[model samples]
Target: MYRPLLRLLPALLVMLASASVLAEEVQVAVAANFTAPMKLIAADFEKDTGHKTVLSFGATGKFYAQITNGAPFDVFLAADTETPAKLEKEGAAVSGSSFTYATGRLVLWSAKPGVVDDKGAALLRGEFKHLAIAAPKLAPYGAAAIETMTKVGLLPSLEPKLVQGESIGQTFSMIASGNAELGFVALSQVFEDGKIKSGSAWVVPTNLHSPIRQDAVLLTRAKNNQAAVQLVAYLKTEKAKNVIRSFGYEP
Candidate 1:
């Protein structure tokens, strides 16, 4: 019996070795606005495929510059379609590897109740000392915020009171820390379970800006990486889509 058990142990060891070989660790550069949902999606993907995703989150424009300069990222999830498309054109990304993963919505959010209204009249009222928004040149949501303000005829008046964040995540942090009374942010950052989690928010209308089509692409460096390929495909799965939707993105 001891001899037979020993024989079985060898087979088990071989199986374990094969499983280890199948697992891959992938490095991903993700948009700051997609942080929460990406965390959930990464967890689910790892559980389902035994693959690991290491994430770096920041402004999409910065990621674009990094990828162009040979950053060691396997994939890029950008806040807007244009950057990914540009990467593809510049040969930094694999040709035809880009696709829209989610459509984002902009929202006016205030940590304090009643500070923001459904129609976003608060911006016109000049009630807040500092209004935080992402830097328009570096972030898609920031550009959208500017577009919204321009459409609503509030840009000039609000410009003086604006506080700029390098990324949407920082913008959210500012509002959460009470550094800014209210500001424009990705709807996903403040939304959960089909509702705004802890703040009064007004969903900005789409007509105010170009559709925020968030796209993902495979970097040319990841062309031969099976783990990177698998992770990209996993993002399109229904499980991942559900998580994205829960975050208020149209996935």
Candidate 2:
């Protein structure tokens, strides 16, 4: 028994040394709309690669401002393609490292069982006092919401009832908390395993608004960080894509 234990010690030490050398921590700034899926992905990434992720979720516009002002984020996952492209142009992100991570869907949702109709006629009916949406200037989902309302010819009529949230996460919170009876939100927020997890919703047609092509990029600050590179690569993996799809996003 003593001889076996002595023989195993070298292998155990080698394994420990490998783990210590390979493991690293990466800081990521993610869009509010991608929060749920990102959390799951981050967990899986850490488990598989022995790397840790520090995630921060918020409005893409705010993240852009922070990144340009020298925020310490190693990676940026934006809610739209433009922000990442802009960062690349501005030299804040590594050029050619950007790619579309997901295509988001919009939904007209209500926490209550029947407040929202399947066809989303509630907007025209004007039954609710407040309709929450993210601030269009700050969030791609909010801009899509505006476009949908316009396409349905309800913007002018429903403008008075519109309530703006600083980010999509806040808008979802408003609807979930009953502060707004119904609102426009990302499908991922209320969907799970091929259906809305709770409440009622009408999936907004893609034709109603410009496509929401969310993109991810490696930030210049982490250009040489191995963990950052691994994280970006991890997002493109089949495991990550599956998680994204489970959250109702097209990966």
Candidate 3:
């Protein structure tokens, strides 16, 4: 009886080892504007998959620079379609592993309610002294902001009032702190899906500018990583799609 029990013990130990392997953590590089939703999604992902996420949120441009210089990232969630495409083309991202995971919408937001109207043209009118927007070079939302301004015919007129932040997160802080009366931030910062927050905001029309296609790509370095595969599978599910939509992004 003792010898038979010992024989079964080896199989049980092997099962335990397999479970530990499935619980490994994956590291991810994501865009700063996704911070809130990523936090929520990561929470759900861990619960569902028995895996962990080590997320780094920042400007896509900076993330790209790091990955190009050997940043140890297993996955990249970029703010723009172009960044992911570039990485794939350059061989830093696994070919055919890139896809649009979410669509971004920009918003003109103010800490004080009624300061901006539905059209948000008031932002260009400069009723406020300073307007905080992310650097167009670093953030897709910032590029959208610039294009929106140009389309509204305010680009030339409102140049002086513009104050660029390093990333959309900084832009949100500037407006939230009232350091800038109004700013261009991701719609997620001002709204949760259909729920609008306190403050006047214009959900910048997607047709007003180039579509902000947020793309996700598995890094070439993660080609053989099971954790990374788990993350990609988890993120493409209905559960992840709902989480992304809850943050005012189009899933």
TM-score of 3: 0.93
Best candidate per lDDT, number?
A: 2
- Name the regions of candidate 3 deviating beyond 4 angstroms: 1-14
lDDT of 2 by residue, 25-60 (tens): 899999999999999999999999889999999999
- Relative to the true structure, how large is the alpha-carbon lDDT of every model? 0.93, 0.95, 0.88
Residue 18 lDDT, candidate 2, scale 0-100? 92
- Write one digit per residue (lDDT tens) for candidate 3, span 88-133: 9999999999888889888888889889899876865677789889
lDDT by residue (tens digit), candidate 1, 1-251: 59998889989999999999989888999999999999999999899999889999999988888888889999999999999999999998999999999999999999988999999889889988999999999899999999999998989999999999999999999999999999999999989889999979999999999999999999999898888999899999999999999999999
- If ranked by TM-score, best first, what sequence of candidates would result? 1, 2, 3
Question: What value does the lDDT take at residue 116 in candidate 2?
Answer: 88
RMSD of 3: 2.3
Estimate the overall C-alpha local distance difference test score of candidate 2: 0.95
Residue 128 deviation, candidate 1, in Å? 1.5
| Residue 135 of model 3, lDDT score | 93
What is the Cα root-mean-square deviation between model 2 and the actual structure? 1.5
Q: Which of candidates 2 and 3 is the stronger one according to TM-score?
A: 2
Residue 193 local lDDT, model 3:
48
